[model samples]
Structure formats: structure tokens, C-alpha cells
Target: MKLLIQNLREYLRADFHPRLYLATAAWLGLLITLNYTFDLEDVYIDSLRGSWKRPVLYILLYTTVYYVAMGLWTYYHHRPDLWRNRRFWLHTGVGWVAYGFYAGFYGYNRWSEQLLDGQIYLFAYYCLSNLHSLVTLVLPLYLYYRFFDNGAEHFYGLKPKRDGLTVYALLLLIMVPLIAFASFQPHFLDFYPTYKDTTANEFLGVPEWVTALVYELCYGWDFVPTELLFRGFMVIGLSRITAVDKNQSGVILPMVVAYASIHFGKPLGETLSSVLGGYLLGVLALSTQSIWGGLLIHLSIAWLMDGAAFVQQWAQQPAGLTP
Candidate 1:
């Protein structure tokens, strides 16, 4: 018990790192958890299709709000150098561009399908499929570049290292529970319900493989931007505001908290899992100075889980499943 306490203390005071990201994450997590638990209907998916204007506007609003808040915090609390890194701007710009591409491409495709075929399910499938793809493919690479390769040495004051075995082991350990919980807990809301619904239909006149392939193309593109904005941009940006030393545990805390909060609308178990998962990912990034490792593991687990769920649902359906 004494040793455990000491370790806990050490983890908290281990380094000069930012806590703002973690704090924001925690707040977001709490908000999501509360909304989920209470069945709050305030959260709405930006389901506007057709025009790029609405989607672009929404993205701009979210990014601007996030940057403004972060900028203010940095201005008041820390020196200008911390917030004025040129690499930060470049990374952010690239990330936004990625986000725009994803939203525009996926959104337009879905709208076109809906307009031409009047297939609401296709539109839904596109959204979910795209989300899953993006989370799996693009997010990790963006994270790798932004957090690990781009500014790791400068901010963390540490050299880059790579250990594939360690990363794989850590990823496996973290993902095991996420998989178990997702499988067993029916009460927990699946993040991509529309996609799940569409995929469950085995006989929609479209081959399953073809549907999956198309979904992957759009989804993969979108996944990159999401990772950049949430994990890459948010985590790295907040690091500037909090200014926690990278050598110690403080650096990991904020990232963990922020990561967790992003999954707020999930079940308690899922929410907690995300927090732990975020910590593990952060640790992986810190140790290896690479997001690729983390992203690969993340994408693998996500695809596996989604595929499993789709298969399970399809198997359970009666002979004629059409939706």
C-alpha cells in the first residue's frame, strides 16, 4: 500500500507537463457521461448533407473555439515561446486541411447517394463506415507526425526511440478490455449506430465486400482529421498552455484526460476504458516518439471490433434481413 501510494505520487509529480488538455478531456468526458447516463438529447450529429457550407462552417466554429480558448489560456499562464512554435501552426494547418477534405468528400458522397437513390440507409452507412475508416487509418498517422515526429524532441526534451515489441504488448493489454466490454455490454451505445444498422443487412443487393470497400475509402480519409484535431492538435496544443515538463508523468496526464473526455457519451465502462486507453497511447507515443505504432494498434482493434459486431448482428438475423 505504501509503495503504491509512492508510485502514485511519483506519477503525478514526475515531470513538467501540461494538465490543461487532460482537464479539458475530463470535462468533456464528464459531459458525455452525464448526457449518456441521463439520456440527454442535447447532442446532435451534424447530419447536413449536400452543401459543403454547413459542414465547413461547423468545422471552422469548432476549431476556432478550441484555438481561441487555448490561446487565451497560454497567453495568460505561460511565456510566448511555448505557444508560438512554428511547427505547431504548420501541423494545425495541415490537420485542418485534412479535416476539410474528409468532411467535404464523405459528406458530398453521402448526399449524392441519398439524392440519387433515395437510400437513407446508404447515407447512414457512409457516415458510419467513413468514421470507422478514418479512426482506423488516418488518425494514427496524423498522431505519429504531430505528436511524435514533429515536435517530440523540442517539447518533450527527449530523443526518439522505437520498440515494436513493447508497443504491441502495451496495445494488446489496453485493447483487451475494450473488446470485452464492447462485446458483452449491450447497454453501452455503439458510437456508429447508423453504420452498424446498415452493415447488419446481409441482403441489400450490394455485395458485402463492395459495401465495405467503399465505406473504407471515405472513412479512412476522415479518420486522419479526427485524430489530428482531437489527439494531435488538442493534446499538443494544450501542452503549450500547461507547460508541464516532458520528462515526468505530468506530460501524460493531460493527454489521458483529454482522450478520455472525448468519449463522454459512452457508458461508464467505455468512458473509463478510453481514459486508460488514452494514457496507454500517450505512453506509447512518449516512449517511442511515434504515433504510427499507436495508430496501427488503434486501427487494428477498431476494425476488428466493428467487423465482429457486424458479423454477429448478421448471423443473428433471420433469413431475410433487409433494412
Candidate 2:
């Protein structure tokens, strides 16, 4: 832990810029307030759900989020280089496209038709939605990495070593209580243990725990693409290009604010935490040149929260009944 702290201190000392950081905070804060005030994701994004137009809207949305974050950097630092750099545009522009594909993907809405008379339609809906990140984010991003970035070493910090494994585990352990506390918030249980409403177990003649396990795994899988994009590509990949000032890689804050924007659909508390979480993970990724720690921390916290939701729901069930 001390080693991790030292590394973070070094990153902060070397990379911190007051103007860029403050401007990013003020800009992102306002957007976050407006989004939560009006429920913009559901109100505006979902306004075109299932239509061909939605992905275009999402591309525009994420592009705006990313560009403004970078724009703030350019504005505060007075550097036209990031604007002139084609690599920045290539990296972020493609990201907006991939995010749009994932955010607007409704092809899974039809997945039930391929199953047994759509008997497990809700099951298909929940499970497929969780797994769609593979096609939407992974497939495109991987292609870009191989062809565009020329196959970065350790494949964007996907090393097999046990480096910092203990710290990642400690991070996960610390979040357990926080996850438990948040599970009791209004509308929390209704939204989590995402398979709670799925009748896959009944259709398959198995216990609900079976379906829960399946959905939880898929729920956890969704974060792979997330870590890969934000920590691996955004922080690690973009760092090599020297953003912000001529000698700085302070795009971590920029990535955090943009990352937080994507969380606008969730509760305000959750959205707010994303900024802090993204910064910590981004620092580690930048320091170690590995996203493995971020992936471990991210997936563990997510599954832990989902697990807490499951336990809460189970305790509420009748003595002789099952979900």
C-alpha cells in the first residue's frame, strides 16, 4: 500500500496542473447537475431507443463529452497541438463510435426469438444485454489496437503476473461495506441482481441461484471493455502522445470527467463516485502500465455490489418460497 501511495504521489507531483483540473471540475460538475436534474439519459437518449438514429445520437453525446474535456485542456493550456494531433482524434473518435454501438445496440432485443419459443425472453434480454459489450466495444477496439496502435506491449497492461494483486484485493475488501450500505438506497434493489425478474430458472427447471450465477458473470464481464477502454486505451494509450501541456500527461482528469458523464444514467451518488474511482484507477494504470489492477478492482467491486443485492433480495423472500 505504501508503494502504491508513493507511486500516486509521484504521478500527482509530475502531472498535476491546477488550471486544467479546476476547469474540468467546474465544467463536468455543471453537466452532471443538469443531467441528473432532468434525467437526460432516459429522457433524451432513450427518446430514440431501438431506432437507427440512437447510435448517431450517442456518438454525438460521447463525442461532445470527450471533446469538451479535451477542449478544456486546450483552452486552459493554450496548446493547439492536441487539436492538430491526428492520433488524439483517431483514438477518441473511434471510441465515440464504439461507445455509440454499445449504448445504442438493440439487436439483443430480438435475441429471444432464437430461443425456445421465447420461453425465457426476459432471461435472454438480461443476459444478452450484459454481454453485448463484446461486439460493441471489444471487437472494434481490438481491431484498432492491432492495426492502429501497432499492438502495444502486454496488450494494454494485460499481464499475467501477480503484481499489485494484494492491493487490488484490499481495495475490493474495503468496498464491501460501502456496497452493503448502498444496497439499501431507494430503487437500488429493484435495479440490481439484474436477473431477479428473469424466469430462466423456471424455464430451465433449475433453481434461481443458477440463473443468478449466470447473470452475475455476464454482469461482471461488461466491465472488461470498460477497463480496457478507459484505463487501457484512454489513459495508457493517450499518455504516449503528451496531452495537456508539452511535457504532461494529465489527461487522467479529462478521462475521469468523460467517464463520469457516461454514468449520468445511474444514481447521482454513483455518478459522482465514478469520477473519484476513475482517477484512482487511471493513476495506477498510468504508473504500472497495466490495467490488470483496475480490472481486478472494478470487476470485484461490481460483483460484490451485485452479490450484496442478491443477499438482500434473498432475505426478503418468504421462508418456503424462491425467486
Candidate 3:
């Protein structure tokens, strides 16, 4: 952890620009404010649900928002070469497309599929929702790695690293209390323990824990592709196009802004926290040249949040509160 902190401090000392950082913060704040005030993301996505046009529209929306932030970074950093760089285009293009499919991939009415009614329907809904990242982000990006980016970047940081893992474990431990505190907030409780409102265990003739385990596992697994894409591809993979040393490379901010845009539809506090979280993870992933540590920490906090929500609900059961 000390090493990580030193690396981050050094990197910031070398790269930090007060005006640029503040401008990027304002840009991100404006985007978030506009989206929330107008309900733009929800309105756009919900209206296009179930249509092939959904992802298409999302590509344009995400790309515009992302690049404008990147363009802002470029203007202040004065990286005129970035406009001429082919890999920048490649990273932005492929990334926006992958993100488009993933974010636009809400569950839809089955046009020809078998109808799964009752608790089974809700179970299937959560199951597919959590695991869609495998199809939308992981598979496409892996293909990009195998073909276009073969032998570069440890396959977008998919390879594991054992060093400094103890720090990641300690970070996860620290998040437990924070997550527990969040579980008490009305807004946080509303969206957490996402496996609620279902009794599909009886439908499957198994204990409730069975379905809960499956949902939680899939929920946690979604972060695998998420970390792989944002920190791995956007930060690490995108860095491959540059000639600067990793510490001096100008990648984390753009990725941080782009990553935060995806959280526009989430709770306001959650969306806001994503900026800080994404920036820290981007720095750590670049410093380590591996997404494993960030992935471990990201996935652990997520599971801990759900676990806190679950324990809170259980504790309330004896207080005359209903599940």
C-alpha cells in the first residue's frame, strides 16, 4: 500500500495540472448534472429498449460524451499529436462500441422465447442482467486483443499477479465498514442486494440460498469484464499507443471521465463516487501494469456492499421488518 501511494503521489506530482484537473472535474460535473436533471440516459435507454437501434444510439451518445472529455484533456495538456494517432481512434472506436452494447443491454420482452412467469421470470432477469458483460464487453474486447493487439499489454491485464495482493485484501477489509454504513441509507438500500423480490428457489425445488448464490456470483463476475475494459483496455491497452513512459503517460484522466459517464443512470452519490474510484483504479492499474489488484478491490467492494445490505435486511427481520 505504501508503494502504491508513493507511485500515485509521484505520478500526480509529475502530471497533475490544477487548471486541467479542475476543468475536467467541472466537465464531468456538468455531464452528470445534465443527465440527472433531464433524465437523459434513462429516457434515451428506456425508449430504445428491445430495439437494435438501442446500441447504435448509445454508441453515438457514449462516444460524444467520452471524446469531448478526452478533447478537453487534450486541449489543456496540449497533446496535438493525439489527433493524428491511429490507436487513439482505434481505442475510442472499439471502446465506445463495446460500452454501447453493454450499457444498452437491458432485459426486454421475449418476442418469440418461452415465457418465464412468476419468480422464475425475475430470477432470469437478474441473472442475465448481471452476466451480459460477458457478451457485450469481454468477448468483443478479447477478440480485439487476440487479433489486433496480440502479445501487447498482457492481453489487456487479464493475466494474474501475486505481488501486492495483500494490500488489495486489506483494502477490501477497510471497505466492509463503509459498505455497512451505506447499507443504512435509503438510496443505497434501494438498489442493493439486487437478488430481491423473487422466490425462484421454490420453483427450482432448492433452498433460497441456492439462487442467492447464483445471483451474487454472477453479479460479482460482471466486474471482471468491467475492470478489464476500463482499467485494462481504456487505461493500459490505450497506453500502448503512446511513446511516453507509463508514469508520464496521459491516459488515466480520459479513461476516468469515460468510465464515470457510464454511471450517469445510477444513484447521484454512486455516480459521483465513480469519478474518484475510477481515477484511483486507473492509476493503480497503470502503476502495476496489471488489472488484478484493481479488479480484486473493485469486485470485493461490490460484494461487500451487497453483503452489508443482506445482513442489514436479516438484522431487521426480528424488528418486525419484512423482506
Candidate 4:
């Protein structure tokens, strides 16, 4: 912990550019949230099944705006310097990877008729989901470049260290019980009252591997974007706003709130789980300075939980198989 503080100090001392990057991102996010709250007029739901649209356009538009706003804000704020740095490419590349993971998988699911079918609602959900992904990827890169890249001190007093083994061990320990519980007592945990009992085979009509891949591509992909938004972007962005010396507690506040708010309509148990999960991810992001770790964990959990449901359903089929 002492070493972490020392490293953070070194990173922050190197570069301290208080541009509109963080503020712009926050404002855009606020705009979308507010729009959703007030202009609920645009919302659309399927008539028969009451599903949202396959790919919610409003949501996508909002997300696109947010990403464009952040990019433009960053480019304008640090034009000459950012142009000169090769790290810009690295940052952009990472952002694209994150985006691809989000859009490709989600898009596939949207195409496969697995997602909500109400056009407006679907659009909103997709947009928000993608926005979350974009924030997660870009926010950290922004912080790393703005502060840590130049050996500057961080406000959160966090230092990035690569302790792969420790991370694996922690992840394993945390996940083992969850998996066990889900297997034996799936009813004990219900994050969303609207939960669907979807199975890979039933949904995709294929073998285990193919069904798993499809499921992962569609549902599992959203995990990355979700983590990126709450844990990656919100956490780091808030840290920058508050400054590091304010204490670790302050640093994680935004992340926790954002994480919980994202699940506003979810069940109490789910919301509670989200709070705990968000905090855990925030800690991991802060400790490692790598959103990738959180993303991996998020994706893994999603896959396991969703996959388990599929497996269970498959086991109960008349032929012990999916359609």
C-alpha cells in the first residue's frame, strides 16, 4: 500500500492537465440520463411480448454522441500534444477493441432475436451499454496518459502493479462460492425480476461449443462495456475530478454510484450484487490501473452464470438437449 502511494505520486507529478476531458464525458452522460428520464415519450415496446427493439436506436445515438463528445473534447483539449504522441494510436486502438467487443457481440444477439424488440427502448439500452464500454476503455487510457504516463502522482494515490498471480487467486476465491451457490441454489440469488431462462442450445440450436460461443458473443460481450463504464471510466474520471489526496474513499464513490444506478430497474438482490460487484471491480481497477482485469472478471462471471442456466435447462430437456 505504501508502495502504491509512492508510485501514484510519481505518476501524478509528471503531468497535470486539467482539461475538459473528464467534464465533457460526465456532461454527456448526464445529458443522456436526463433525456431518458424526461423524454420518455420516445420509448417503444413490442406489442405482443412487450419487448424493446432489437437494437435500440435512441440508446445507440446517445452512446455515439457521448463517444464523439469525449473524442472531440480530448482532441481539442490536447490537440498538438496528442497529435505528436504515438500513445494516441495505442489509446484509439484499445478503444476500438473495446467497441468491437461491445458492438459485435451485442449486435449478433440483437440480430439473433435474443434481445428486447421495442425499437426505442432497445436503442436506449444498446446506446447506454455501448457508452459504458467506451467510457471504460477511454477513461483509463486518458488517465494513464494524462497522469501516470509521465511519472506523475495520482490523486487516488494508486500505483499500477502487475501481480497476475494475486489477481488470479483473488478472482478464483471470489468466484468459487458464487458458482457453487448458483449451481446448488440458483433461486437464492436473483438480480433481475425480468430474468429470462435462456439456454445456449435452446437459443442457438447447436452443439455446446457453438451455443456457448453464440451466447458469449451476444450476452457475454456486454459485460466488458458495463465494467468499462462504471469501474473503468467513472472511477478514474471521478478520481481525476476529486484529486488523489482526498482519500481512496472519495475516489471510489462515483464508480459505486454509477454502478448501482445502472441497475435501477433490476431486483433488489441484483442491485445489491451490482453494488458489491462494482466496488470489487473498482478496487481491482484502482489497484492494477488496468480495466482489462475487471473486464475479464466481469465477462467470466457473466459467461458462467448465463452458461450455467443454459446447462441446467439442457439437462432437463426430454432428450437432455436444447432445441
Candidate 5:
């Protein structure tokens, strides 16, 4: 127990930067204000159905608000050196452009499915469809890092490191039962198994399990872009441009705010919890310089929550019957 506590302490060091906090607060405040002012969260969710206007407004609002907040934070903190860093502005520009591609691709794919047509195989279509995020968010940064930057591995947080693997493992162990406990809530079950369509089953003329296999794989891969964008690019890549020391990364909380904002369309509880979860994951990525652990933890929670929801749905069925 003593050794275990030591290991946890070693990995879980507190990183509190005043400017980062202020910037995060401003970012969150802007999101909350917009959400309350116009019910933007619901509007944004509605946009996924067919309205391009709301999403475009959201992307514009988000980028403008966040960059303004960051600029003010840098000025107030008197970090003219950071402000003058051409790499800083360059990287920030790349990140926002990447975000535009992310939001655009997500909105496009979510609202329109024409690009996903013409696949002869069901699983192939599923796999290709999953590449939507990879193509938009991950590929642009990846290509830049690989070709322009001359390396895509470490900058993208793909380098292998075991620094905090134990802490992450322990956290995952504790999280599993807590996630199961949450799964028992009616609201939780209603929101999960997020792969609701199941149209693939009928389209492929295959059993539900077969379709599930494809859906889960695609769903799991969805996080790759997520991690790459937030943890890899925003946190790690931005650190190179903004870090003042080994321990302090100015970009962490800003990334957290943006990461949490992306969850605005989710359930309120999950969306709020994302702030904390995103922060912790961002810290881990910075400390260990790898996102694979976070990837594992995210997939574990997502798949487990999905499994729990499935189990609850099964149990709710009438006396030993299959749906």
C-alpha cells in the first residue's frame, strides 16, 4: 500500500498555472454563456441533423473566444516572449485549422452520408466511414508532422513510454466498478450503447453480433483523432511552443476547456465530468509523452459502458426472450 501510494504520487503531481486557469475559466465561461444565452448546446446538437448554420457559428465562436482568451492571458501574464514566438502563433493556427476540419467533417458526415456510399462490403464501408475523423483531424496534423516537421512519432505522442502505465492501470481498475455502478442509473443506460442505428444488421443481412463487431471497432477508432487533436497536438505539440519549464505547460487547461466544450452535446453530467477527466488525461499525456495509455483508458471506459448498457437492455426484455 505504501509503495502503491508512492507510485500514485509520483505520477499525479499537481500542475496549477494561473494564466492557464484564467484562460480555461474564460473559455468555459464563454461556452456557458453561449449555452445559456441561446441554448447553443441544443442548437449545436440540432445542427447535426441538417442545419449547417449553427455549427458554423459554433466553430467561429469557439475559435474566436478561445484565441482571444489565450491572447489576453498571455498579455496579462506579461509573457511577451511567448507572444513573440512565431512557432506559438504558427502552431495555434495549425490547431484551429485542424479543428475546422474536424468540426466540418463531423458535421458533414453526421448530416450527409453520400460520401460513404458505393461500398460493396458492409465492414469495408464501416471501416472507411470511420476514417472520416482520421482524414480530417488526424491526417492533416500527421502529414504536417511527418513531412514538414520531419517526424510524426513523438510529436503526435506515439512514442512508447511506461512512465505512468502503473498509475493509469490502477486508475482503470478503480474506474471499472465505478463505471458499472453508474451504468445502473436509468439515464446512463439510456445514453449509452451509443451505437443505436443497428441498420448495419439488416443491410448486411448478418446477425447483430457481426454488425456490433464492426460498429465497436469503428467507435473505438473514433478516439484516435480525439486523442491526437487534444492530447497529442494541443497539449504536447503546443508545449514545445509554449512550455516555460519541464513541469509547466501553458496549453494544458486551454486544451481541457476546448475538449470539454466538444462534449456539450452529451448528457450534462458527462459533459461536466469531461472537464476533470480531460484535465487528468491531458496531464498524463504531457507527463508521459504518450497517448496510448489514455487511448486504452478511454476505450476501456467506452466499451465497458456500452457493454453495461447492452446488459441492462437485455435484462429488461420480457422473460428469456431475444430482441
Candidate 6:
């Protein structure tokens, strides 16, 4: 514990920029306030999926504004060289394109037909459909990394350290109750577990429990791509292009804000909380140089919360009944 504290102190001393930190806080606070005031999440989701035209326009405008701001940020740090750097442009292109493809996958799934019939087939389809992060995000980012850095091991926080794992595991243990406590809230139950259809009796003659187990595993696996993209690619990969000093946390700000923005579709409290959580995880990934810890905490919290919800629902059922 002392070592963990000491490491965190060192991280703070090296990576925490007071002004940038304040800027991130203020920016996220304002965005959250406006989000609740205007209910912009609904608008944002509608704009993204309902129509092809709105989605395209939103992507174009959002990406343009994002890159322009990023260019200005790079300039502010006196790293104008990044603007002309082929590697940086390539990274930027791949990142946005991957995100677009991921979104497209979800949108397609939403609009597509239920052609597959059996419960097992449908369940598998649902799980495999989440591969947008793997297929589009991780793969392309890795290829890009290999192309540029000659297959560096630490490209996206893949190389884990013993001390880092210990610290993050302890941190994950500490978050157990926080997740449980959050599960009691009505709002939390509504969104958590993210898997709604647990009432299926069987799939391919397999029992419902077996199918549920498979579903939960896949559900947990879904977060792998999330960790890869936000913590691994965004924090680790993009940090090279944006940070003036690779040792500092300046590059983490953009990723943090963007991460928070993605949570806009969630409940207000969770959305607001994601800003701090996202930033901390990003910093942890940066400090430890591994997403394994982030993945552990993320997957644990997610699965536990889902379990809590399932238990609560079960308890509410009649004595002889089953979900």
C-alpha cells in the first residue's frame, strides 16, 4: 500500500498539470450540465443512428472540429511538426475511421433483420456483433503501430508489470462495494448488465444456465475492445502524436473528454461519474504502461454490477419462479 501511494505520488508529480487538469474538470462539468439541461444525449443518439444523412453530417462536423482543436492544441504546445507528420495523420485517420466502423457495426445490427432463428444462434450473433472494436479498432491500430514503431511491445499497454498489476488489483478490490452500492439504485439497474434477455430456456438443447454463462462471458468480453480503444489506443497510441512530453499527462485530456462524451447515453449520474473514472483509468494506463489493470477493474465492475442486477431481479421473483 505504501508503495502504491508512493507510485501514485510520483505519477502526480510527473504527470499532473494543474492548469490542464483544471481545464478538463471545468470542460467536463460544463458539458455535463448542458447535457442534463438540454437532454442532449437523446439528440446525440438520434443524430447518430436514425438517419444516414444526420449521422454523416455529425461525423464530418465532429471530426473536423475535433482535429482542428487537436491541431490547435498541438500548436499551443509548440509541436506544429505533428500537423505535417505522416505518422500522426495516419494515426488520426485510422482512429476516426475505426470509431466510425464500430459505430456502423452497431447501427447495422440495430437495423438488420433477425434472420438467425435459434436462441443459441441469436445469442452468439449478439456477442459476435460487438467485434467492431476488435475488427476495426484494435487490428487497424496494431497494424498502424507495427508500421510505424517496428512492432514495439508497449504499443498499446499490452506489456504488463508485476507491481502495476498488484496496485490495480487492489484498486479493483476496493471498488467492489461501490459497484454493489450503485446497483441498488433504480437507475443503475436499468442500464447495467447491458444484457436484457435472460429468460431464454435453452439453446441447441443446452440448458438456460449454460446459455446465460456463455452470454455473460461474451458480455464481459465486450469490454475488452472498450479498454483497447479508449485506454490502449486513445491513451497509449494517440499520446505519441499529441503529447509534448511523453512522460506527462497532457495527451490524456482529449481522450478523457472524448471518453466522457461516449457515456452521454447513460444515466446522468453515471455519465457525470465517467469523466473522473475515465481520466483516472487513462492516467493509470499511462503510468503503468498497461491496460491489463484497467481491463481487470472495468470487467470486474461491469460483471459485478450485472450480477447484482440479476440477483435483485431474482429476489423480487416469486418463491417458485425463475427468470
Off by over 4 Å in 2: 115-117, 243-247, 318-323
- Candidate 2 per-residue lDDT, tens place, 1-323, comes to 77578767877776667987888888898889889888878898888868988888888877888788878777765666778888878887887799877888887877655653466888777788879888888899888888888646656677655666677777778778888899987667766755555667888999877887888888888888888888888888778775443236656877888899888877778888898888888887777778888898888888877778878877889999964
Q: Pick the candidate with the highest lDDT.
A: 3
Q: What is the Cα-based TM-score of model 1? A: 0.58
lDDT of 4 by residue, 1-323 (tens): 34434534643343223454355446545644654565422333112122333124323433444345435544543433433546444443343444333333343234334454443343334334434444444555455558644533442223344544356347656876766566445553343112243343444456546534543465565565565555554455344443424332233533444454444343334545775566555655655656666666676666666556655655657974444
Task: After superposing candidate 1 on the true structure, give the runs of residues whose Cα lies further than 4 Å from its correct spot.
Answer: 1-26, 33-106, 114-164, 188-210, 213-271, 318-323
Worst 10 residues of 5 by lDDT: 111-120
Report the candidate with higher lDDT, 2 versus 3.
Answer: 3
Residue lDDT tens for model 6, 66-126: 4644543454455677678786667666666666556544443542335444444456556
Find the number of clashing residue pairs for candidate 1: 15
The estimated TM-scores of all candidates read 0.58, 0.92, 0.92, 0.48, 0.82, 0.82
Candidate 6 residues lying further than 4 Å off, grouped into runs, are 1-4, 14-17, 44-85, 107-115, 118-125, 149-151, 198-200, 241-245
| Residue pairs with clashing backbones, model 6 | none
Where does candidate 1 have its weakest 10-residue lDDT segment? 152-161
| Per-prediction tally of clashes | 15, 0, 0, 29, 0, 0
The true-structure Cα RMSD of candidate 4 reads 11.1
- Judged by whole-model lDDT over C-alpha atoms, candidate 2 comes out at 0.79
Model 3: per-residue Cα lDDT over 1-323, one tens digit each = 78768878977986788998998888888888899999987887658888888888788877887788778767877787888988778876898899888877764235112467665887877777777787778889888887887548578887888766776777677777777778999888888877775888888999888999998898889888888888888888888775366766678887787788887777788888788788877887887778999888888888888888898788878766665
The candidate, 2 or 4, that scores higher on TM-score is 2
The better candidate by lDDT, 1 or 5, is 5
**Tens-digit lDDT track of model 1 for 218-316:** 554454444444444445433443445543323355345444544444556666777666765555554444455555566666666665566556666
**Candidate 3 steric clashes:** 0
* Cα TM-score of candidate 2: 0.92
- Superior by TM-score: candidate 2 or candidate 3: 2
